[model samples]
Target: MNRRLILDVDTGTDDAIAIMMAGLSPDLDLIACTTVWGNHDVDTTTENTLRVLDHIDHSDVPVYRGLGKPYAPIPFLFPDYADSDRTIVHPHDFPIASRTSDVRATPAVEWLVETLRAATERVTLVPVAPLTNIAAAITLDPRIVDAVDEVVLMGGAHALGNVTPAAEANIWHDPVAADVVFQAGFERLVLVPLDATHEAIVSLDQTRALRATGTPAAVAAAAIIEQRITGYNEILPTGAADTAPVHDALCIAYLLDPAVLDVAPYRVQIDTVSPLSFGKTIVDVDNRARSAANCHVALGADATLFNDLMFRTLSEGR
Candidate 1:
């Protein structure tokens, strides 16, 4: 039996790769892919999602646009660059359009609420971006907490942060929304943070191998990586100069094969106050701050097996 899954993405470079992985998986019946605002604007992310699906000949997957901003009003900053006026950080950069596409008539949060309410089987929600839409849906209908089977997301960081000295980009973008979702206390919430994603690095050689797959998704995946990769050069871990971490793809890989990740329970809190650490995810590992474990934080992964799955997923529908 195929598990029903829904992808909530911001459609960044890794998000696009993860989209292909989810759309092509034989073990999963991808019901829908909802877009959010994180890597770029919701419009651009939604467009990129459709392009990826269409390029892979899976355009039938209904793409919907989610929240455009965080719950509380704040200065909207583009990922990797701050903008007080909320202008386009990079006009010609990624999330560039490959082909034109239209979004669904319904809002993402509305669809989310209705879908969960109507589903006979518990749905597996994979959120690889900020938790704005998920938060909204939960706020609209709290019953989704029980309706959702698992939330395997790619956000937060255990020891190190990507956006700032104390926050990962996804959780950092909308800590208020992240806080809402985390505090709701889903029974099976697995957070695949940067700590685990960094371990699953895809190097230049592996990217070359993926590009050689000759599939449209694979070719576009290679191009997107090459185009948006330079910005991450300074953040690449030691001995990974020619490699990039497939952050969101690792989360989907975990869903397909649990053996790819190593997780431990942790009590987490999101910092909503404090301008310096607005979107910081405070993880309690040693029981110093919190009493019970609310979320399962992934600390490590089997990079070898993850890369194999990524390549295999990208190699399909040729």
Candidate 2:
């Protein structure tokens, strides 16, 4: 009994690794991919998704383009960051001679509604990007919430923020959207926030160890990971040496092997009122007031087991 999943993502290098992990998993069936805005612009994200699919020989997977920006007006400021200064590299640095295909120009909301209506089995919406598309979909039809089996999102943080002082890139990108989805009240939800992902990093040694697998996907992942880890080194002053967080990959790993993670159930809420805590995920790890638990969050994970699982997936994917 394979779990059917639809991955809505903004294919960052970490996203690519996650996709590869999902593709290789026998228990998790990846039915589709939807591109969103995060690590790069929506257009570039879609291109990277397609390129990675091609590289991993999984191009048959349908990729739908998602929301380009937030629903409401947002104050925009161009921040001078080291990661921003790095050259934008497509998944395949070399362009394919084949003409690029046009993405689903229609809104991600439409696709979500249509896909849910058509799904016979419960579909898990694994959104690893801003919640704009999912938010819009639920807004279109409130009943759409019932159609989903679970939403295993890779965003937010109970602890430190990844983007701003109190926000992860995905949640921060569209707090309004995140608010909508959380309020929709899906029955089964699991948020793989930064608290766990921040603790999970694949060091340069790990990448070198993986590069020895000799799989095309592994080799490509190693190369992209090399760029990411190097970027991290140049951007942040890290005392523990350099590594990529493998943020999105952690979500998929937990999906495929729940035992790899130590999860704690809790009542989840998103704080949108505070300027600093706007997109913060307020998860009551302790059963305070004995309210109904809304989510099962990964509190701790076995990093060694996770990396081993990732290596096995990439090796078998070859």
Candidate 3:
């Protein structure tokens, strides 16, 4: 059975890989791709999305431009814009990521709301960026909660976080909107947090394997990953040796093969107001907190099997 998917992305390097994975896969029907602001600005995100879509001949999938910021405005007032506010610094120019021409319409929030409301089959919502657009849709029509079948997102972390000490980049980017989805009482919610994703690493070997395939998808993925790795190494001290943990792709992988991951349900909450802990997803494993478990969280991933699946996707699965 082919599942209908509405993928929400931020057009980061990992997101580019995710777009290819979902768009190329025959098992999933990517109805539309809604771009958000996280890895880059709304405009950059949209452009990168179109570029990736162009790579796999999925330019037909409607690309809707989304919000510039979170549904709730930023709380802290920085008199000056910080570097963090700007686009994610990529190592390579990503000439492929820079396609300003052929941009489509805007106000993705409307399309998101209308599509969910009108869909006959329940659509699988895969949000790989900040949950701004998802929160926006819920605000316009809270009833869209019931319309969604499941939400598989890539955000948060189990213990260690990549963004702040307590939060992952996606969750930290916009914690308020994340709070809405966590408490919206959706029937099914699954998150592929940093905990599980860090295990499914894309090392040099995988890069070579992908490149060796010589397919357009494999070549494109290798190019992006290799360039990103180079960039990370040059910018950060620990970048060179760091494995490319294509975080966003984990969510899509989980949707296709649940066996590749170890998912467990737990009561989760978002810290929306703490300066130190904002955007952190707190899971109550002891059930000490209030509210029943509203979502399933991944604690572990079968890295070997996951690598195999990813390789298969590039080689033939897609």
Candidate 4:
């Protein structure tokens, strides 16, 4: 039986890959997609989501727009706005990222809460974006906290983060929202953080190999992967070769193939106060007695097998 899922996303290149995986993976019954503002603005996220759905032939899956800003008031900051918090660079500066110009009718938060309440089975929220929508859903109806089977999120970093030295983009976008979800005492919440996503990087050579598949899905995937790596190389100066980790895709893959991820019971907490560590995920790796265990976090993964699955699944056009 396919697991019923609602994907909350901010269509980054990786988010596109995740959507493709959900559309093709037999293990998932993707009910809908909700767009958020993380990788880019809310408008772009919603538009790109439609474009991606069109590619995967999942246009029938209703897409909902989400919060335009953080759950709490955030300073009106822009990466390009001179003297407007220039220190905090937005992830959109990356080359591989794309932004769309359209917007949608419904917001994601309302869709999430109402959708779960209506579903006969416990719904799983696969959040590959900021936590604004999830937080809003729980706040709208506290009962949803129990109705949800699980929340599989792709954000946070057990170690260092990509967008900031301490904070990841998804969590940093809305730390308060993230904190609420982490402390809500949801029965089963799993996170595939940077620690695991970093392990699932698709190298340039690997992407070239994927192109050999020659299907529409495979070609589209290869094109996106290529754009992703090119952006990574241009944005971050790394000694290693150019490659972009398919961060969001791993969340769906983990649900489909648990063995692709190596998880450990972790006491996870979000830092809401520290200026430098806001949204940083604090894991009790030392296994101290005082840390409260609330979530399971993936620390390792098998990238080779993951890439193989992506190639085969997309090639077969499932």
Candidate 5:
């Protein structure tokens, strides 16, 4: 049976690839896409989500707009790395085509609460952006936590941080929201963080194979990934030439095949107060705190498996 899933995204380049993977994969039944504020503004992310679905001919999936800012006011202003020319984080490379689908009138949080509350079957909540929308939904209706089967989010870091010296971009964007979600007591919470995503790098050679498929989804994904590679090489330097980590897409890949990642239960906490460590995910891997594990943190990823899945699914566009 196809797993029922909903994706909450901020429509970054990696998030775009993830949306395409979820929408195109036959293994998943993508019920809806909820857009939030992260890599770009909410409006840009929403429009980018529509463009991706339209490009892949999956406009049938409905989209709903969510919060435009973090749930709580951030204490300090982080550097706008996305605005820097060296980073080039914006996902504006997609060809501008006439949008066929529009965001629903109902707010994303409202729809998420209602859908999960009324669900008769299991539904996986995949949030590949900041935890704003998911945190809002939980606050609006705590019962939805019980309603959800699982939450596989793409954020945080175990070893090194991407945005700050101690934080990843998604979690660093809204540590308060991430904290709320982590403490909400979901039965199953799987965190696919930078530790694993960085390992699931997609090389330029792999992207060439994706482009050779000639499918619309494959072509678009290739272009987006190539852009990501260029940016990573310029800014982060993934230690590999002509390669980048499509972080968000790895979460979708994990849903399709559990073996794609190796996870271990850990007591995870988010730092919302410290200026130097804000948004840092403090994972207790050694049980120093001796608290019960609240999250399954992905420690490793199979890049070969990820590449195979991306090539197979994106090649056969929906």
Candidate 6:
């Protein structure tokens, strides 16, 4: 049977691609999408999620609006990136003229608690944005931690950071929530951090091939990826020229094919107190702490396999 999956997102460019892949993949049953604040405000993210589902003809997938702010206010100040031209923070240019559906009446945290409590089968939770909603759900109902089959989240980094020298945008946005989720003791927690995603970069030429597929999902994915490439090149240039990491989509790729990532067990902790290192995922790669591993942190990715799965899935549409 296909794995039951729920995607929690911020509906930025990369998150949009992840949603399309999950919504269209035959290997997964996408039960719903939960939106939160990260790359954009919660309201815009919800609208963007609707836009993606409508464009891909997957309107049946329910979306629930979640928290607009962190579980608690951030104690320290950080760069807002409001002036940055990065596409990840701005609204995506999907072909859909307008949103076709609204989010469900139930708040995301409540829906998560209810759904997990009532689920007869374990569900996979993929949170690519901030951990606010997921953390809130767990806080509300700690038993739901056992209800989840696995969590493949797209955030954090070992060697480098996207938002700052010490943090990725998602984790840095709300370290308290990330800390709660990490220490919640889920049986299987997979971290697809920048280390893995940067390795699975997509180029402008590859997007051209995607657009040539002539499917709505493929075309929209191509446009979104191109925007990412432009943003990355202008802001945070990757190892390769004309290529950019579709960070959130790599989490979906790992689900479709576990081999897409090279992972290892590690005791990862979030730095919540240090002003300089706040939101950083301190992965004990050397095992100096001698702590039992709580998370499977992805350090590498197979670009060829990722491209193959993503290209084929998005090209086929829903």
Per-residue CA lDDT of model 1 for 29-112, tens digit only, reads: 889999999877898888878887877778788998998998766543434533321122222355435655568999999999
| The 10-residue segment with the lowest total lDDT in model 1 | 82-91
Tens digit per residue, CA lDDT, model 4, 129-165? 9999888888888788777888899989987677677
Per-residue accuracy of model 3 over 1-318 as CA lDDT, tens digit each: 799899999887888888888888878899899999888788878888898888777788889999988778757532222244223334225546434346556578999998889878899999999999999899899998887889999999878676667778788778889998888878899988988887777777788988899878788888777765564454432333745577788877887798978999899998887766776789887788766789999988887777777777766745
- Model 1, runs deviating above 4 Å: 75-97, 234-238
**Residue runs of model 3 more than 4 Å from their true location after superposition:** 77-92, 95-101, 231-242
Score candidate 4 by lDDT: 0.78
Please provide TM-scores, in order, for all candidate models, with all chains considered together. Answer: 0.91, 0.90, 0.91, 0.89, 0.97, 0.97
Which residue runs of candidate 2 sit more than 4 Å off their true CA positions? 75-106, 237-239, 287-290
lDDT (Cα, tens digit) per residue for candidate 6, span 52-107: 89888888999999999998778887675533544443444544457677789999
User: Which scores greater on lDDT, model 4 or model 5?
Assistant: 5
lDDT of 6 at 43: 89
Worst 10 residues of 3 by lDDT: 78-87
Give Cα-based local distance difference scores for all models. 0.81, 0.77, 0.79, 0.78, 0.90, 0.90
* lDDT per residue (tens digit) for residues 31-125 in model 5: 99999998888998999999888888888999999999998998977785535632385545554355788999999999999999998997999
Of 4 and 5, the candidate ranking higher by TM-score:
5
lDDT of 2 by residue, 1-318 (tens): 988898888877888888888877878888888988877778888888887777777877778888787865445442523135334322335222232445656566788898787777888889988888888888888887777888888888887775666777778778888888888889788888887876677788988888898887788778777777776676543346876577788888888788767778888777666765666778887768578887888867778878888888997863
> Against the hidden true structure, what lDDT does model 6 obtain?
0.90
The lowest-lDDT stretch of 10 consecutive residues in candidate 4 is 81-90
Worst 10 residues of 2 by lDDT: 90-99
Candidate 5 stretches greater than 4 Å from native: 85-87
